[model samples]
Target chain A: MQDREKAFIRALVRSNATFGIGDDGVEISNFVVANDAFFEDVHFKRAWGSLESIVEKCFVVNLSDIYAMNAIPRFCLLMLTLPTDFKEVGKLAKIIGNCALKHKVKIIGGDTIAGDKLHFSLTFLGQRQKSRILTRQSIKKGDILGYMNPSSVLTHTKTQAFGKNTKILKTALRFHQHRKIQSNTRFAKPILYPKMLLELNSIARAGMDISDGIFMELPRLSHLNRLGFKVFKPKGDWLYAPEEYQMLYAIPKNKLKKMQNFAKKHRHSFVPFAKAVRGKYRESKKNWHT
Target chain B: MQDREKAFIRALVRSNATFGIGDDGVEISNFVVANDAFFEDVHFKRAWGSLESIVEKCFVVNLSDIYAMNAIPRFCLLMLTLPTDFKEVGKLAKIIGNCALKHKVKIIGGDTIAGDKLHFSLTFLGQRQKSRILTRQSIKKGDILGYMNPSSVLTHTKTQAFGKNTKILKTALRFHQHRKIQSNTRFAKPILYPKMLLELNSIARAGMDISDGIFMELPRLSHLNRLGFKVFKPKGDWLYAPEEYQMLYAIPKNKLKKMQNFAKKHRHSFVPFAKAVRGKYRESKKNWHT
Candidate 1:
């Protein structure tokens, strides 16, 4: 987050003394509520993907927040701002409806309006699972920090492809046989292991989804837990790739082998790249939000 | 709602077989979930009111939905889009925080991002009161349709004032002593009688907030209840005025005396302008959404 945004949120947290603002979602009675905004140009370019893919990505990202809290998404409220010239309203609605059906979430209520840009803000209400809600504030000093990296080359290439020119992807999608790229891009279909994350809830001391990359999230974990991270030779994209949607977790040092076994059974490469240490940690100012 | 928007929502309703999409808010368990968007220019022009008042109106409008459903708003998630050059971040946070505090609503979780225009999408979760939840589908034939019109000339003037050029209001607010206008306008501070509405829940067979005017909302009630409205000599603005934030209710015809007595005790004029009849009702295409 930028400095101004941080200051604004700080003011809000200070003013609302009882606000639990640090978690992915707030727990109220047995329900976890979360919201996220996916605006055109800011979150995605129209030329980069189809509307179906864009809508799917919006759902995936918001649902990730719910899963990170160890809750099952049960209902959603969508606020859509459609452009004036935008047609194909039926297609848009079907995509959303189908997404909700596939996820077993009820389409409760929301508002739709016409505007100059296409913007979507989704609010999801999730029910807690059998285990306790996982949060970023429960890490211990001896916890081992690891992430469930789904072993897929297509996913890696898709994340890398986002930094390239959108014009090339647009042209390729229009003319070339790029069905694989169209279907496999992370922006269109983000990889999320909900079952794995939910099962790991028993062992995860602290956890959150990697939306703004691990480098950006580590400091938050550090600040919340009052400890620094001792890196185990962290490399390249693992540190700075935003919107990974992977689960970053702090596990008990003794439960590392059990967590690894669970991850291995799920075809996920569990990378324990850091350990919680007793020190202050500071991070670079760069982030997905500008 | 416009034809396209209607069609879009119809498609959504059809696709999601179990969706309960007609009410002002959706009831899940004991909570009512509602969402609304207050986009810049679309909902209100910045030149028309102060940022603090603008923010306050946003809260009132969303909370009105909760109250109309016979529930008390307990939590909210805000999705804010801040313009690039926008300042006064601290002031905005304080206003939001204070509004949440005033309504006894917790600021649970939300997302904030920088964009080209100021937009806010608020999702409110309200806890149901002792009375059963009021919805639009329960109005029966011969039920009296009434609205709680707070006896205030300033509110009427404010609704009419929106029709005039905004430049006049802008210039007046800038140079003249318009403190009254600054704080009293419906756009700045909408009038909502939550206590009165909640108390009347026992008698209201059906109810909803008059968001897009009585004319626009009548058809919705008509369609939902499978009955037509017998409007009794509807006057000018009462038919077409939007964003009144007043509760439009369906009361049993025999309970008119009790409803009137309740309104009189609360110092509100309960205007019974219509009755439910057996037929069809159609509305003009013009609405706030366009």
Candidate 2:
């Protein structure tokens, strides 16, 4: 989180109104409500891709939160702001409706208005897992932190396409000229593993979708779990690459073998890079989200 | 609704994903979920009021939907976008938290980001009434359409405060100079009647919050109920005034006396201005909402 957002949320924490403010999505009885905003120039630009692809990424980002919690998304409400002269209103509605139908989520209701920039704020209602809801607070002091990454071939291609440790803004600008951005590029149709997340629900102690990169999410998990992390050097550009939409999980020492086996069978890499310890841990670098 | 929005929603009506798109809020089992977007230059301007008052209006507008459905609001999730250089982040959070607390709504999780303009998209989860859920589709032919208005004193003052049928944009600019807009002014802390709405829940057959003025809303009711309205010539500036946040209800002819008595007891005027008929009714004026 950005410092300003963190400070703002700290003040909100003082009020009784804040009940489930720190999780991926707040659990309300059998449902989980998650919301995310995608604003023009801040999150994406029209030059980056087609409107269909842009809309798809917005839906995928919100769906990641639901799947990370082992929940099935059921309903969707969209608050869309379009430029006054922007045509293709019907196409926008078609894309949104088709995406909801593809996910089996009902488009219940929302409000749309005209504005200077395009903005979409989507609220997703997901049916919670019947037995348990995975959250970030359940990690233990000795839990091992692992993250789901794409296959080795895709990772190698991504590394070559964007170069190691290159900021996303530069890559997005470079790829925009080609007009053929590979799906492996960050923020281009993020890959989510729902089935693996469901399997890990029985083994992992806690988990969340990594949108703000591992460098930023680790401190949040550390604060929530009241434990520090014994960090290990990551092999590639995965540490600070934002918008992965992949799951970061904390697995107990005993269930480590089972989790590894599940990831291997699913053909996904689960790279363990940290272990929870006694002291606090903070990222030295500033957040790129702001 | 604007012409573009009407066309956009008409296309969405084709998909099975759209279940309850024509109501104040979508009823999902026991909960009613409503979402609305407030954007700078579109909904409100920073120069029009203090930040606290602007934020309060955002919450009140969403709450109006919940009360219009006769549901009790339970939770709120906010997607807020602030300018990069804007300060007072903590103050914004406090006002939001306090507003939720005052309304007895829990502040759940949401997303916040920095952008070029201020934007807020609020989602409210409300518990549906146990006995029934009020909707716009239940109005029957021969039903008398009534609206809840402020008492005579406030109405008279409001009539003189902003001249009858004056455009809101010009009035807002003129009022912005004085910096002392009355609470009765449109979009300036709208007055809601929850107790009276609950009382009318049993007497009125259909109801909805009038956000896009009575002229625009009446056609929506006509389209939903497949009946026309014999609209009375309104006495004052009420018909074309947008952002009133008042309730427009459809009551049976036999229950008009009971509804009036209840409104009198509550010190609100129930103005019966229309009756459902077989012929269609269309407002000639273009929608001011766009």
Q: Pick the candidate with the highest TM-score.
A: 2
User: In candidate 2, how many Å is residue B265 off?
Assistant: 1.6
lDDT of 1 by residue, B226-275 (tens): 89998895466677767777888899999999999998788776789998
Candidate 1: regions farther than 4 A off: A153-183, B153-183
Per candidate, the number of residue pairs that clash is 0, 0
What is the C-alpha lDDT profile of model 1 across A196-253, one tens digit per residue? 8888877888889888878888888888889999888546666776777878889999
At residue A35, what lDDT does model 1 achieve? 93
Worst 10 residues of 2 chain B by lDDT: B156-165
Residue B77's lDDT in candidate 1: 92
Q: In candidate 2, what are the lDDT values of residues A165-263, reduced to their tens digit?
A: 336555675665455455546566665557777887667889898887788888888888889999775545677767778888899988888888888
iRMS of each prediction in angstroms?
1.5, 1.4
lDDT of each: 0.79, 0.79
Candidate 2 structure quality by residue, lDDT tens digits, B14-131: 7666889999699986898999988776777777777878888998899989988889889999888877778888888888888889888898988888877778889999898775
In model 2, where do residues sit more than 4 Å from their true spots? A152-169, A173-180, A184-186, A233-236, B152-170, B173-180, B183-186, B233-236
Model 2 chain A: which ten-residue window has the lowest total lDDT?
A: A156-165
Model 1 lDDT, full chain set = 0.79
State, as a TM-score between 0 and 1, how close model 1 is to the true structure: 0.91
